[model samples]
Target: MSTLIAGTPLAGRVAVVTGASSGIGEATAERFAELGAKVALLARRKDRLEDVAERITSKGGIALALPTDVTDRAAVRAAAERISVELGNVDLVFANAGVQLISEIGDLKTEDWDAQIDLNIKGVMNTIQAFVGSLEAAGTDGRPADLITTSSIAATRVLEKFQVYSGTKAYISHITRLLRTELGRKNVRVSTVEPGMVNTELPDHVTDPDASKLMADLIHQIDVLQSADVAETVSFVAALPKHVNLTELTILPTAQII
Candidate 1:
């Protein structure tokens, strides 16, 4: 009922954010809180989530730290139920849990591939499955319910050593688009956000030396995208008018050609 300029557009709204321990997910949760949303932070790190919740609560925003592994369907479901009971029906769900382990196809690490598939793909599915019902149930209360996933530019670009990671992201991007078609009729908006070279722990998780060096060089050469940049994109999409759904957004640094 409030405008983004006049006051908190998300005031009185309930938002659930996965991967809230750090990076873009954490930034987005904090931004949502600043906009007066009651935020539920979900992640595997209880300590980190607690720290984030403390920061939000100290600033007069409501926050709940729920340590959850997105890869676990039952746990994700339980966390969603808890948030619904404690805060209210979720108006926004940020399915942002992911991992980036890069290696060339010839030297592929099967374990790493499995880990990426589980978190990057299955995790996204679990997050959406857990909260979509709530979003569907929440009719247009002046603003449409939103579900946004943190996809990546790798979905479309063929970054060396990122075959598995890119594959997972591509799946997410396609899935989000399909969901929009089904959920739009119910006033539930689904969006996929693809960001390029964000300064986050994602690159830190890279194990391949060549890939690491390539990423490091890119970061050093170009003014890299920050977590807040992606977070701002998430907030903007969430704050848009009910009829205006930004179904897909691709954010890249000016210098980033890929």
Candidate 2:
């Protein structure tokens, strides 16, 4: 069992977690709440969001479930505004919502490619643009605030049928690096978590039959990392001291490989 020492590191802080309906996002929200942060859960599914919120509340943690679609700029902005108004200045923002599609270039559908770009790229942009001001505002207190995003190992390695998906993740990595440079002077920290072979709904989005089979086989071949693994990493980054920023972390199951 992992022990949680609670009091100062994240006490009285407010965090917004996008894609909080399930998977890594949901896990991260729960972990943050456990660490004494008031958490805002944002995702498109109202029922699912409420469920997560209820879980946190039941556990004696503060939580708000805001049904949101990260792909919609206006919705994202409104969510951010509401968090600022209700939760006070935001202390952390986790742009953890994403999708994946795998197909060969010849068989790849244009619409699918666009979907990946919009959510994986543009969605991230909207989250950052919406909450950046809040992060800046929080910095005035002389404490470091954080912005974290989830990228996959695919970003670094180009696997056989995941061209567009890999492209989107690669873009995430690039944006994270640039944002780190841009936000450094502002006392806001930016970090990226790259996870490999996690057991989640990621494979459900794979439309290509061949690719789906391949992914399933790979999962069976390894004791895939769980969503909790990535969640722990997010909490670790958030718990770091003001001047110490864990820039990037890559996690993979012991049996998995590039």
Candidate 3:
């Protein structure tokens, strides 16, 4: 994310990214660090999180990996406390952790639905609760602060077998808007990035045969957005002037009709 970007615009800032184990989360964290922001990585995949932190450090960047289950509010809070002591108050946060489980409505994949709800919706709430205080403080002190969430084009696109996933993303997009009512007053920028069909490990987790085939066909047919592409867009959102807030951003490949 940094190599493509021009200067150290984010220097001296502290940024946190959830779902840092892979894909968008990993790309965003690395980019922020490269831009000179102290980074904290949060994810359930401890090994991968550590690996990501090592990659940032190898590049002479500062990063702290804190393995966390974002669904658990308590764990999120604990990690926030540690970040405060070690990295100072975080000024930018990318609540990017989420899961995609595609299944038919008649199939009633309760487990899959629960997993998406827990990690996508509940996890976002936990992250916001854990760090909003610091963001508020930063804003009150006339500092730059941002709270950004990773939503999806599914929130508005009507895709078959993506009912539950779409609902979860819709919640995220709308919630970001609502959060701005208060956080914006504090001078903290709150926004959401909704990306279409990024080529990532997310699709590999699809269990339904028809849904999997549909996603496969789409990827094979057209150019899909890469995780790094989304990361760059997100980094742009964060690096924007504090007075400007791109409240909702939708990123998609030029060839992607949907």
Candidate 4:
């Protein structure tokens, strides 16, 4: 079989993925590299970031591993400067750094709620703040620019214990809609990918025993979507024609009712 399909579809493009250490972020970074985009990975895990970058480089793909805590604006901005100097203008950004801490509203796991708010909501805002300038510049240069955010079906679905997590994701979904109104005028595509029950480490973080069992049972009951599945959708969005924008997509496993 021919490797990498036809010509490099994303040749000369620059992609930045937050939470690029694992799951959807890592998969999408590798996919972007496969299509010839110079990729920059930003996340808190230094070791894992290096591992992803090493694998991509081994396959003759260019990748930059920038260990960053997305909640830290200064750190994110510093990393953005490095990306601009090393990878050129970043036209593609995936604000995918997030955590799912599910618990009942009355239980009041305030710490868990804070963690979700910091990483899922504030982190996304920081990423957009760092990259929007470059994305706008790319648009001015008549190039395709895209900003994609990873949300979850929990955003809309009425789950019992996913109060804070759902709220955070809903923030992401709506923010993407609002961002598109402004960035879209500049020809920078802004979209959100809302996946339903993806088989990712996110489920492992739920400390609520009831919620954990519910998630475990759901995973066992169906073939949950994998990280690669979501990555493919994200890459497809970025690879479309410059004028085409797939605004909001909800990806669900065939067996998943929601």
Best model per TM-score = 3
The C-alpha TM-scores of every prediction are 0.95, 0.96, 0.97, 0.96
Tens-digit lDDT string for candidate 2 (1-258): 264545546777899999999999999999999888899999999999999999999999989899999999999999888887887788799999999987778964888899899998999999999989888777767776999999999999878988888899989888888987888788899999989988899899897898788779878888888888888888889898878899888999888767
Indicate which candidate wins on lDDT: 3
Which residue pairs show collisions in model 2?
A: none
The sequence of per-residue lDDT tens digits that candidate 1 reaches over residues 203-229 is 898879998998898899999988888
Return the TM-score for candidate 1, rounded to 2 decimals.
Answer: 0.95
C-alpha local distance difference test of each model? 0.90, 0.88, 0.93, 0.91
Worst-scoring 10-residue span by lDDT in model 2? 1-10
Give all candidate RMSDs, comma-separated. 2.6, 1.4, 1.2, 1.8
lDDT of 4 at 7: 57
Residue lDDT tens for model 4, 1-258? 123234578999999999999999999999899988999999999999999999999999999999999999999999999999998999999999999987778877899999999999999999999999999999888999999999999889988878889999999999988998899989999999999988888888888898898879879999988888888788889989999999999999889886
Cα distance off (Å), candidate 3, residue 252: 0.4
Worst 10 residues of 3 by lDDT: 1-10
Which stretches in model 1 have alpha-carbon errors above 4 Å? 1-6, 140-143
Tell me model 1's lDDT, rounded to 2 decimals: 0.90
The superposed Cα distance between candidate 1 and the true structure at residue 90, in angstroms, equals: 0.8
Clash pairs for candidate 3: none
